[model samples]
Target chain A: MSKRSDPRLIERVLRGEHAAASRALSLVIDEAPEADALSKAFFPKSGSAQKIGVCGPPGAGKSSLTSRLVAHYRKQKLKIGILAVDPSSPISGGAFLGDRLRIQEHAMDPGVFIRSLANRGMIGGVSYTIFGAMHVLEAWGCDKIIVETVGTGQDEVEIGKVADTIVYVTTPSMGDEIQAMKAGVMEIGDIFVVNKSDLHGSDKALSDLRSAMSLGRTHEAKPWEPPVLGTSALTGKGVDELGKALDDHWTHLKKSEEGRRRLREQHKEELSLYISRRVYRSALDKISDRNLDDLVEHKIDPASLGTKILKK
Target chain B: MESKPFRVLIAKPGLDGHDRGAKVIVRALRDAGFEVIYTGIRQTPEMIAQTALQEDVDAVGLSLLSGAHMTLFPQITKLLKDRGLKDVLVFGGGIIPDEDVAKLKKKGIDQVFGPGTPLTTIVDYLNSRLPSVKKK
Candidate 1:
């Protein structure tokens, strides 16, 4: 648990050495010594790769569409990294990361590196280790990095904190789910994709998404409105348009510098989260288990007890 | 960083269609606070080993219900060992008989767990082998 990250390994990764990137990433996820050093080493050279978040409800073909998006990027001869965040079972700390199954054909391609992160009970639809994984990818010179989120509830807005652009994919029959999203989660998408267009009611899904995106949205204050495009990842329909839409969003970010600002905020947020967790955990370790029993017996109030613990 | 949650892969090797036991163990492993990667059914030894390599997981548990443990489990262990993954412990369960269990251990499987094995029996077996928790 206290393994020091081999600086030689970090050095190999910096030189774009083979297999070193994955090894560095393993250390990153394990929270080994190399993670901090690796982060510090690569962050100054970060912000060069574009980070995009693809999210929606389960069964929305999010993975399929992601495959198409990766193909599109690879055609441009760009290196790609995919971090598919799959929800962990609350009962068992296990997850079925089928995202790789859909995109496994590209497994051997040196240009593509796909790994799935078990959410480990994180509520933001992403694993806590995502930024670290992204760090490895960026340091390895990935041209584009895509984060496919655990298609859960409205919490997917967390992706915006990590990605430059957000693409929310849905199907023709997802109107009910979209209706339930209200304005909060729907407002997060920079581009809306109504996938499975070859199916019936495709038009209705597109209309439903467009209407939801337009109503009471605060982001419209900007010049760009979230565009709703239809795509069928199975037949590769409308994938090009979706790719174009992403390109346009990237161009806008370059023009407005919002991407750079968001990247800075992400780094700051990641650091703060790590600090809060470490500091709070050490504080908790100092508190006695007897105090927990006191709380159950109505012997002490939580606010006062928390304050006392922090003061220690 | 605090000690990481143990990462284990629960896979159904070969052409077995039944995943009920595999899924149940997945829950048990997860609840034990181990990071369980449940690779779906009918995976080849190649696919399972490659997945472990990419994820850099700590251990792999193959759920072999088809009585192919003699052939399937050893094949997977060999593949993993060939890829310089001898350190990645391989454990399994299913209809593996007592006699075959010894055969498997000889063929490189770290442990052979039979069906209905207590969750902690397996969980403890694993936790026992992890490096002792020495403080930084």
Candidate 2:
């Protein structure tokens, strides 16, 4: 385990070796502090990689769309990084993050780097692996990165906190929260997409998304209003347009001051999460099943126990 | 820390586009609590072998229905052998004949599961055969 800190492997990764990067990411996913500390060396190289988050409901074709984006970016000779998250193993509570890409297409491509992780093994539901992975991708010299979250529900907007540009993918047959809601996950998107446009209600879905954006809770005359686009992941329709829209959003972020502001927020959030995890684990270590048992039995109180652990 | 979860790479080799079987196995293993790494479809022997090595998975399950299993199965096995990844168990499924299955098992292919075999059999096979990972 002490040998996991060997810097030679990470050095290999930074020197444009994809296999070494793969090994580093595996160690990073396990939350090895040394591996993460190695990643911090690459922090200065970060903030340059374009962060794009593709999130949507289950079965919304997020994977296929991401595949299209990979192809699009590949055409421009861009080195790409993709962090794909799947589900947790039902029994062991281990993450079952699966690789969604057909390996033959891009596995051989030197310009593309792909890794999979899941939301399991979270410390108080805080994801440090992802943040570390962002750095790893940047250090690996990827020009752009696409993070596709495990398809969460309409109200889950965690992806927005990490990604610079969030693309909300939806199909025409999705629920009403995306179209007409007070404050659902739909509001977090910087670009709205109605995938599977070949199906019925695609027009309605697009129109409804546009209407929602008009009355969007965050649509308060901002410099960058999100564009609603229709796409068919099956036929690769409108994918080029989607790519263009994402580029436009990137342009807006850079042209205006909001992009830097968002990056600042992202940086702060990331640092805050690291701090919170450190504190959480330290505090958690001082706790035991006995403390919970005592609390449950009314032998001890919650407030005092917290203070006692903190004092230690 | 306990043990890392058992991770499997479910790969499809050759031009078989039918993923209904692959997906079924994916869900079953996921439900049974194993991380399934799927790199995509129409993969080559090199891709599967390299993916297994990179992911450091405990096992590799190849699904091929293109009648190329006789070639693809042993090809993946030989690749794994060449990479010195002999510890990584190799199993496969899809339209293979009984004779080919025997031939594959002889070629260092661990097991060949054909159609109509219960998903539970594959699940059980994996559970019993593969070693669990060390977790924290």
Candidate 3:
């Protein structure tokens, strides 16, 4: 384990060797004992990459739009890292990660590194592995890291905690303007894009999104106003504009106090995620089957057993 | 912490547009607790190899129905080898003669599954041959 986290491997990762980066990411995903050391080694080299989160409801063309964004960023010679998250089956604890299908054109590009991750039972459109994976990509010298979340519903706003900028995508005919009015994910967007603008009622979706943005909540004015744009990831329509919007948002973040606050919040979230995972695993490991059976058979209560496990 | 699941890349090479069988394998593998990355149809050898490298899959499953498996399978394995992914288990499935199975294996394909082969057999094969239960 110590040898795996050796300085030579760290050096290769810093040099952006594909094999090293992949190996480092696997260590993190597997939660190997050396992952802590690797994370510490990579932490200082990270934070330079622009982290963008693409999220929306299922079938909203999140993957397609993410591929378009990768292309847009690559045009400027920026090395990009893509982490596409897919759902894991609760029944089998496995996943079918197919997001790479849309981005296959970039499969052979040296400037781009794309990996598909199973959500691994995380409910907020991403897995706990994501934070570590992002650090690995950042350490690998990716100028931009785009995380495409598993299709999220209204409340899966965890991306807002992880990404520097969130691009919320949606398609037409999803619902009425009221759908956008109801708060949850709609509020987290730094940029709202109505993808598949070529489809019917795209204009209406665009208008609805715009109207929703204008009806901001009671909070004081934010320096950055979320822009609502229409785009077609298929024909490359409005993608360039979306790219510029992302860049502008990054610039805005760098200059604003909100950006620093977001950085602090991101670190806090990372720490909490790590602690939660550790606690969950340890608690489960400490639970005895007798206690589990007792709880299941109503011989003991859950709260008492939960407290007992924590004490243990 | 959650145990890392074995990741596999299931790709279709050559001009075979039908992915029904590949999709079935994908689902079966997923149900059997493997993370399966399915690159749709008509994937070139280069694309498959690149995806496997980036995904860092423990295995690459090539499904070819276009009868070009003889050429494409070796190309993919060679590409994977050249890219420092020789450790990745390379497997194939399609309509191939029994004689070609040994030939494919000699060229770096680890295993071949024919049509109507039981899904559990495929699952068990992966479970047994995957490099380690712990790490990729």
| Candidate with maximal DockQ | 3
lDDT, each prediction: 0.79, 0.79, 0.89
List the pairs of residues colliding in candidate 1.
A92-B30, A92-B31, A93-B30, A93-B31
Per-residue alpha-carbon lDDT of model 1 for A206-236, expressed as tens digits?
Answer: 8777776566468438667889899999999
Q: Which ten residues in a row have the lowest lDDT in candidate 3 chain A?
A: A1-10
How far does residue A184 in candidate 2 sit from its true spot (Å)? 3.1
lDDT of 1 at A113: 78
> Tens digits of per-residue lDDT for model 3 on B58-78?
899999887888899999999
By DockQ: ranked, best first: 3, 2, 1
Residue A16 CA error for candidate 2 (Å)?
A: 1.6
Q: What is the TM-score of each predicted model, taking all chains together?
A: 0.85, 0.84, 0.95
A1-312 per-residue lDDT for model 2 (tens digits):
553445587677789776667667777777665766666677888788889998887788888888888898999999998888776744666455553563236766778877777667542212567888888888889889988887777576777778889998989998553444547667788898999999988988888778866774463577887888999878989999998998998889899998889898888878887788778878988899999999999988999999999888
- Candidate 1 Cα RMSD after full superposition onto the native fold (Å): 3.6
lDDT of 1 at A44: 69
Steric clash count of candidate 1: 4
Query: Model 2 misses residue A121 by how many Å?
Result: 5.8
